[model samples]
Target: MSTPDRTANAPPLDQPAFARLPRDTGGPVFAEPWQAQAFAMAVRLSAAGWFTWQEWAQALGEQLRLAAARGEPDDGSHYYEHWLAALEQLVLAKGLSNREMLRERKEQWAEAYRLTPHGQPVELSAAMHGDHAHARVLGN
Candidate 1:
């Protein structure tokens, strides 16, 4: 198997703020599949009337500025981290999901990722079956 082309999922560079995205000739480049997923989520959400493109741009720009202020190197290595943070913040502000729910879902994904065999797509159900989640909580 080969790595998927994450760039194919990249958001269109319509927003001027998107100029900050790391890109290649094929368009925006994502370091990971989840990064592309997050990008697409924001685009879809905005398109669905959850927010306007301008609001998304402002939130993303503010996230990048906050990261820079916290002394993150401007090497583009953590762009998706900031992207996810901005998305979470916006989602909270929009009342789409609360912090506790987000935390639980994140834990679910983390556990699934941990238990998954290499090269297999992780499944959330894998995190909850039998004693997998319980054992991880007990640090076993």
Candidate 2:
């Protein structure tokens, strides 16, 4: 899917909470496709009125702070991990999904990953049922 315009509704690039985001001259950079997907999910969710930008900044800041407190490496590799964590928390807090459901879906993805052959796309089993509306948004 096309990314929303950076010059449009995106938060300011200079925000303190975003200081550690991996970026280059053009803008934010992602080491993997999933990273950009996560970033876009956050931007879309916020714009959709799920949360305000300040709340997003605070949630992301808290995730980064917690990661630092736990002594995770400061390298940019984990930035999107923190972003994903923050997104999960925000979605849960907003009552979009419950903890049990989220846990199960995560486990499903883990299982699917383990069951897939190398370099092949991972797919959840046919028996799996998920909230496709939200799952699609989060790239689950």
Candidate 3:
């Protein structure tokens, strides 16, 4: 999808609200103002069974500080990657999902890959081969 165009006279990145905006890959300038706000909303909604606008503001503020320290500038960044990271952080913070669940999912996927005939696992069940099946014992 085409991204919306930002005005040339757009406000500065460090202005009143933009100064504390979260970094997002999508939006006006890769990491434009509202992208971070959107992510913060999702995280807040998923946590504490609440969605206070003030809490969202605080979360974005903290996220902006952390991203800036990590060298995330006013320019936009990879939106989906940042979104995933935010979700992970919120999940961990709220204890919604455990590390073991993530690890288990990773291992299960790895095993599925290993069991596939080629290096890549086939998504269709009919794609599995029985080449390794033992031949019937002589005259059973």
Name the candidate that leads on TM-score. Answer: 1
Summarize candidate 2's per-residue lDDT along 47-139 as a digit string, tens digits. Answer: 999999999999998998787778675566688999999999999999999998988777777766765788987777622446443343244
Across 4-118, the per-residue lDDT of candidate 3 in tens digits comes to: 7767666446534545666455545425555666565575575657445554455555666567668665443454455555555555666767887666555544444555677
lDDT of each residue in 43-107, candidate 1, tens digit only? 99999999999999899989988876686665677888988999999999999999988887778
Off by over 4 Å in 1: 1-28, 117-120, 130-140
Residue 73 alpha-carbon offset, candidate 1, angstroms: 2.0
Runs in model 2 lying further than 4 Å from the true structure: 1-28, 114-121, 127-140
- Per-model TM-score, in order, reads 0.68, 0.63, 0.40
lDDT of 2 at 57: 95
lDDT of 1: 0.81
TM-score, cand. 2: 0.63
Number of the predicted model whose lDDT against the real structure is largest: 1
Please give the TM-score that candidate 1 achieves against the real structure.
0.68
